[model samples]
Target: MSPGTNVVIALAISSIVIVVISFRNKLVYRQRRELHGCEVPPSLPQLDPVFGLDLILSRFTSLKADRRNVSLLEQFRRHGNTFQSITFGRTTFFTIEPRNLQSVLSTDFLSWGVEPMRLFAFEPFIGKGIMCSDGAFWEHSRALIKPTFARTQIADLHLDDFGVHVERLIDLIPKDGSTFDLQPLFARLALDSSTEFLFGESVQTLAPDLTPSSAESFLEAYDYGQSCVGRRIQLPKFNFLTTDSRFWKSCQTAHEFVDQQIQKALLVTSKQKQDVDGRSRYILAQELLRQTHNLLDIRHQLLNIFLPAHEAIGVAMTNIFFNLARHPRIYTKLRNEILVADLKARTLTFERLKSLKYLQFVINETFRLNPTIGTNTRMALKDTILPTGGGPSGHGTSPILVRKGDSVVFGFYGLHRMPNVFGDDVDVFRPERWEKLRPAHWSYLPFGGGFRVCPGQQLALTEIGYCLVRMVQAFERVENRDPTMEFVEHYKITTESKNGAKVAMVPSHL
Candidate 1:
């Protein structure tokens, strides 16, 4: 054959190969769908369907408007409990259905992995540990950290140690009842408490007289890194284009701080030369060292644990106070309950805090309205079927085929707002609803569900409860000071009020 003819033949072969490879996954999916009686969920109508450029642009727009969660909830409202959309050309499944979430997070949990985008986004600051790893590594990380939060450790709230920080928090409040933002104070309190709990010493960001320049730098760096990581998670694939020198510096500073703590803990351990039972002491750094003496590994694990604990505790407290300030009647009721019980700071144990039924209701309602981690995504590791989101109507109760590599996005915010599960007044902040409300399984995942459920859940709730009871005890009344009564979202690694918990307190003595 002539050279031209040979070239044409090669081009034809290449075309055939491309077509076969592209259709192979679809053919497999179709076979599975037919065999299992699965159907595709409704797809979001997109002008740029192939690349989903329209969806991508709209996401950015929603983000800029500071309504990303609202925009997502609206999509569910229009589509149904479960729907499909092309996000930046990737096939994505969005679901607020309990059944589907149950499968993804628990029943068939192994079939899904941590969304790679999240790992990519978080690894720079947190490195590879529980929060950013999957498979055996995640399992190992979980196993390593589990003992640190064992029942014995978590129950020992060390009220005396924590009370000191709460006292500092209360002192910072204006005595004359001037308006103040509680968000930052909450953040500092969380950081100080978490550091002391995990590192064997507090950074003491809340104590200006005690905090050194290095401590302040560490706090600022961690905060900056967290903000950067939050942005990076949104567009992980293109993070290179967005990341800057400052983010790198912040990561370095945060790492150095953790490294210093690791060294101190190691030195203490060596001097004592005792097999420290981390579960007995509830110190994360010491526990991590017991697992592995590798300095970098310990640093990564510490930061990973710190990120969620700090963000979750801080943001939850802020939202709780935000709601409390606006709802004076509920606040009064909560105070009465605490006062009636005659609980003191010294007596605030894990069991006693849990016994505060109304306080638990308020916390539940706040989390239902504003989950700290609003939306989470998981990547399908193998072809599987979700129990719902199928059939011709798109909302039909049939299994939906989820192909390997597809992304599953579940929104706790939307799930918590389901009319059927949470009632018609889903938007209203009503603590009384929890009195008789029992949401469907997997529908009320404030701390998530399944094997990967936050190990820090108990500790976080205890911390929030401890501080909340203290605040209520210290003040006669909490008054909303912000002109805007609505809770506007300020998204970071976690979500908090954009306008913050701006309020004034009437000191009980006054």
Candidate 2:
């Protein structure tokens, strides 16, 4: 044999030996960490067909609901609560487990962060707002808005703007008995209220005789911009070839609408101080400017609050109304609950509203079945560990190893509907279940959990609950135009009825 050929063979053998030794060293280090309790348990069991055409196909297959979420639920049902996978070229860890949830979202929150992809996708509209940005920016943003979202401020809005919108909504309803998709009506109602609550000037979406309908374009822009953000996240981030001109157009429209509002608020604020109407119903922009004069910063924060607050609140009301339409029995039961409270008060206040237990149960039930923002997807900022699904040695109580750059997605619908946490009839909507089934905080996240929990949670609940109670108070009957309920495909922004929820209203003799 030639000396050159022998040298090449020798080099190949040496390379193989080096690889083997490196592998052995890594295995030994992992074992040492596990024994010393310095690290989480071994890696978790990965879900099959992890990231490829098959996974994508399964996700898009079900047109009945958010196919991606439906796919996640199917996997959880098959492979315990915590399962690891590779999705869109990134290592992803998904969990519906209570303990793991507490770790990822609360206890070890510093270890995990909001997926950067989300920040980039939403940056066009929300900018460096609290929802997408983290660290000092998130802290600063949270601090500035915290005071404005106080209970007293929320109560004032509920009592004033919210009540006004619902009254206009009643007038808009046709007594001619024709069924209309109530989702748009609810959106219009929510938009009108959110405008006054956030901007200090009602957009007058209801087109009342005294006011003109002016916000139609603004609402359209907001919806398109948000939905595009959802779509962008679903697409592969590394793919340079991908582009959406339409999404940018929507962004322009939304930015123009919001920017105009911000300028108007600034012009007004410059002239005179806003009246402190006891509860402080100052426009959010004015309150925001008190902390910073940066128009860009103000624009982002205001947009962040406006878009999701508008879309999510609207969807919540629509779904609750849709569900109530199907279950007239729940309507009557809730109305009775409201009437009993009615005798004790001249008008309902936030405190009085909180006292209505059954109303809360209904609200809880609605949020459980349809969490508007279903998944809480986060990324690992550093090498970390999840609390469970670490396989045999500890009966899955062992911690699961998570690598930096990996994603942790908390599917709310899957978690909330888990049989172990919520009981056997998890899929069924039973308001009474709130009576018997009480799960851990992380397990029952409707507006997320821990430090990153939704800031507008109280405000959203007040509006949704207050609207429903007042709705049932004014009208006796909520009849479904269709016998069955159907859900639209998920846009990642929020869910809606596939076909608008058609319903008929009948007055109850007051």
Candidate 3:
């Protein structure tokens, strides 16, 4: 035979082998599904199955209309607890079922990883840190930073250090009950306190006169960079399309500020100026410095903690005030609880704050309505089965097949609003419900769960509780100033009100 004829024959054999292997794999998968009683979850209706351009456009439209949460909740309502959709020719699973969440987050954790989220989205912005990495790297990152949030460290940092920032925040509140937005002030407070916590130096954004030019620039760049990161995460598969020169510039500015802080810590370490052995003072950057001197590692780890620390606390405070303003009765009740407790006479330590049941309830209700990190996505590292969220009707009572490389997206916002768990009045903001509410495990994850649960949970709760108590103590009642009493979402890495929490406060002395 001629050379060309021989080549054609070889190509035909390769094609035959490929087809045979594909068929065999399908057969094996089918047999496994049958054996395990796995079924495909219901598919979301999509106009374009190949690229899912329609789904993407619809999402962008919902976001622009400020109804992202509404749209997402509607999907779970229509498709039940679990469903599948095609995005860029890849099958993505969506679930709000607590059992499935338990499986993905804990029981079957090893079969999933956050590699896609890290590589496609966060690494470019935050670098590879604990929140961004998976597997061994994530484990190492967690171990290195966990000590900084130890009970001893958090308690030591609270009270004296936290009170200063709270005083500044209160001083800014209007005395005349004039309408004002608390969201911006909350952001400033969070940035100030978070910097102090992480770097042992506060940016002091709340104190304009004391703020430096570099600090102002850092705040600007950091805010812009985080906003951009939020958008990139929204479309992680298309991050390249979202990022631009401005985004890169912002990331660089934020990096420079962090790098400067790292240098200061390094200088202190080199001179033996910091009493590392005594554990007298705890700074996240210094703690990281003790672990490794790698500038990038330290910067990334600090940024990772700072991002959540800043955003979560700020967002939580803003939402808490948002609800408190609209729900005057609840606010009054909460305030009465605080006053009756006489926390002023006693030092408000970490344990003391945790004992305030009503305050805890209010915080819990706020988190349920608007979790800081609303929706999260994870990728399957291997073929696995979700505990439920399958079958013909998709009632979420049958095991579902999850293939390798599939993306599983869970909406905590929806999970928190489950009628069966939270009652038919899930839409209402009633902190009293938490009095007897016992949501199943994995159902209420304001700070997330499993091995990757937030290391900063205790610190976050403490800061939020301290701020809430101080605000309530100073203000007799909160009045909603916005025309609408409803909560609108301004979602990013976290969700806050689109319409700033506009409200007036009645001074307690009056």
Q: What's the alpha carbon RMSD for model 2? A: 4.3
Q: For each candidate, give its TM-score against the true structure.
A: 0.95, 0.87, 0.93
Point out the higher-scoring one by TM-score: 1 or 3: 1
TM-score of 3: 0.93
Q: Which is the leading candidate under lDDT?
A: 1
Q: lDDT values of the candidates?
A: 0.85, 0.74, 0.83
Q: Rank the candidates by lDDT, best first.
A: 1, 3, 2
Q: List, residue by residue over 297-333, the lDDT tens digit for candidate 1.
A: 8888888899988887789989999999999999999
Clashes of each: 0, 0, 0
Off by over 4 Å in 3: 1-24, 236-243, 269-279
Model 2 alpha-carbon drift over 4 Å, by segment: 1-53, 62-65, 151-153, 209-214, 238-242, 270-279, 343-346, 392-395, 486-489
Score residue 251 of candidate 3 by CA lDDT. Answer: 80
The deviation in Å at residue 277 for candidate 3 is 17
Candidate ordering by TM-score (highest first): 1, 3, 2
**What are the per-residue Cα lDDT tens digits for candidate 3 across 1-510?**
999999999999999999999899779888988999989889988889978999999988988887777788899988898899998767898899888888888989999888666655667667888877888988888888998786565654445667788888898889898999999889888888888878877878777368688877887887777767777776847656454888888888888999998887776644222433444657778878888878898988988888898887888999999888888899989989999988772367678888999999999999998888778888998998888988767685779877788889999989999999999999899999998998877899999888788888888888888889988998998899999888888766677788888999889983
